[model samples]
Target: MKKTAVKKTASRRPRARLKKSPLPFVDPAGQNGLNPEPPRAIFLEQPAVYPGTAPKAPGFELPPDYGDTKIALFAKDPWWLYAYWEVAEPDKAREAIRGLGLAVQRTVLRVYELATDSRAAERVSFFDILVGSTTGDWFIDVGQPDKCWMTELGFVADNGRFFALVGSEAVRTPRFGVSDVVDEEWSFSSELFWKIYRASGRIGAGASSYDVRAVVIESWQESAALQKKQLLLKGEGPSSFQSRGSA
Candidate 1:
């Protein structure tokens, strides 16, 4: 009897996976008090904006659907106005900010577009670096930060220990658009957001509170001598020495 060889057949259909969008209603520690993660901007709701509240984008900026239910924030510093939408269906809330590459801007942050990916962590790093540099200073020049972080960068604490931290998190939308190709007409509907901040900079990561505080204060100032000026203070007004001269 002759032996016959059997052949294997492949299926016509491909593997199916869930189409997941970045978390909908994301509130980084900066503003929206909900999520309270780091990179959260200082968001304070202004008085009833009423009819003149947030302006509408001709095509996508201000959609009529946004409704008056929304109030203007960052009145004094209306920089990053995070937008969110809630769908009563399966009880889901989404951040409609990323779907549209509507271009984020701030008065002082006009120097650079931050033209790369921006999520919570980068924001955290940006803030961390900012606060860590501006301690006790007025104005500072800011720039778009590079996140490829390598070479073991860190801060030196009073104890003479070099403190370094490594952070990781989901990437922000648009900048990468890894999920989908960016379309011109941007809206909150397809917006995608993620948690971002200095991951390992906290106490749990071996960094001291003093170092963290120093970084935070210095971050507010963005100058060339940022760290040098902030970290190394003048030193208690030049330690005076009271000694009698030898005769």
Candidate 2:
């Protein structure tokens, strides 16, 4: 009987919505409305002007200064010498050529052999070479080794007068068949002697031990006789011969 009573509830109300404003009208030809004015333009300020003399025109540049002429020489080998030179100031070279007062056809290289003594003026020999240009290199043949040499670059005048421009330092040629550093004495070791003897084929492949020994003894005796003969031919006295033979 208590479940038969039921309570009644009130109904809910819906909220009210606000309306949006309309957009402005636009013309397709870029004119929003009638009597529209054109847009104004902005520009940067100009540079200031000074009333005075005009700028000068650039002139031609001058030539650069150069160094003096130089010469050098070196020994290429026992019988050859190499010489080279450079003419830095060509104007000076031209002036000298003009001063020669001759029909200059070639540049001349004069080589001289100096004495062993440094302070001596005794020239052993002299020679000349003719070239087309002032600046060049040359390989000279100075025959006979072990000598001091000097050289100069110049031009020969019509009257045969030599006009020297540059000179090189003294250079010495090497000796023949030997180096500057000499050994007092030289000898072969027993091991090296045996190697050389075997390589010389004195003992054949089929030789026995006794046969090898006999061959070696015979070779030693022959070599000793030859050496003694050579010493006698070279004017060795009997005392020296006896001393060497005993040793």
Candidate 3:
């Protein structure tokens, strides 16, 4: 009975100790383990330059004068006429005018105010502009609107004889005001004209007739208020000067 089985406490088996091998020495920055490999070298390909990618050179210059004997005229607005002419070179001019016994002294632009639109119309008046030998262009002020004009590029002789070298075709200027020639089929009355004139003002729907009248009056007054410098003599008003080769 005393031999009571000493409850033998079951001894738990000891766990096996894992002996881990020493860890590899890491870099201070921890980027690589103990034996850090050398860094790799990267290569990049450069783009090729093409001939078309280069900048272009400056443009070619135009000749100042063509060795041709020609003249051109153009109308600028209702007041001015522009004329450009190219005479033959000195040698050519002399050769062409040889045996003419015309001793050229100076260049002159003879502006003729014609009576009609015909190229051979009767000359109503004439004026001369003394352009030096080297002038290639000129501006002529006829000072009369709705007239025909022709210009002649000629050399003035030392003895006052004018030798015409080249003449331009007659060009009629545009009428500055309303044309006098009315169509018989379409009679434009003064009332219609005034109506159109008022409509051109674009008066608002709510604008009264008095407002329209005021607008018309203001416009009329403004037109009448001319500057002293703009006032020409009785017949010296600017004509319709048009360029050549135009209708």
Every candidate's lDDT:
0.31, 0.74, 0.72
lDDT of 1 by residue, 90-190 (tens): 11111222223222121111111223343222333333222231011122222222222111123333343333322222222222224455663332221
Q: What would the TM-scores of all predictions be? A: 0.13, 0.44, 0.51
Q: Give Cα distance to truth, residue 103, candidate 3, Å.
A: 2.3
TM-score of candidate 3 relative to the true fold: 0.51
Query: Which one is best on TM-score?
Result: 3
Q: Model 3, stretches more than 4 Å misplaced?
A: 1-57, 95-102, 187-247
Q: What RMSD does model 3 have?
A: 20.4
After superposing candidate 1 on the true structure, give the runs of residues whose Cα lies further than 4 Å from its correct spot. Answer: 1-154, 157-162, 176-247
Report how far off residue 26 is in candidate 1 (Å): 70
Q: For this target, which candidate reaches the highest lDDT against the unseen true structure?
A: 2
Cα deviation of 134 in candidate 1 (Å)? 16
- On a 0 to 1 TM-score scale, where does candidate 2 land against the true structure? 0.44
Clashing pairs counted in every model: 31, 0, 7
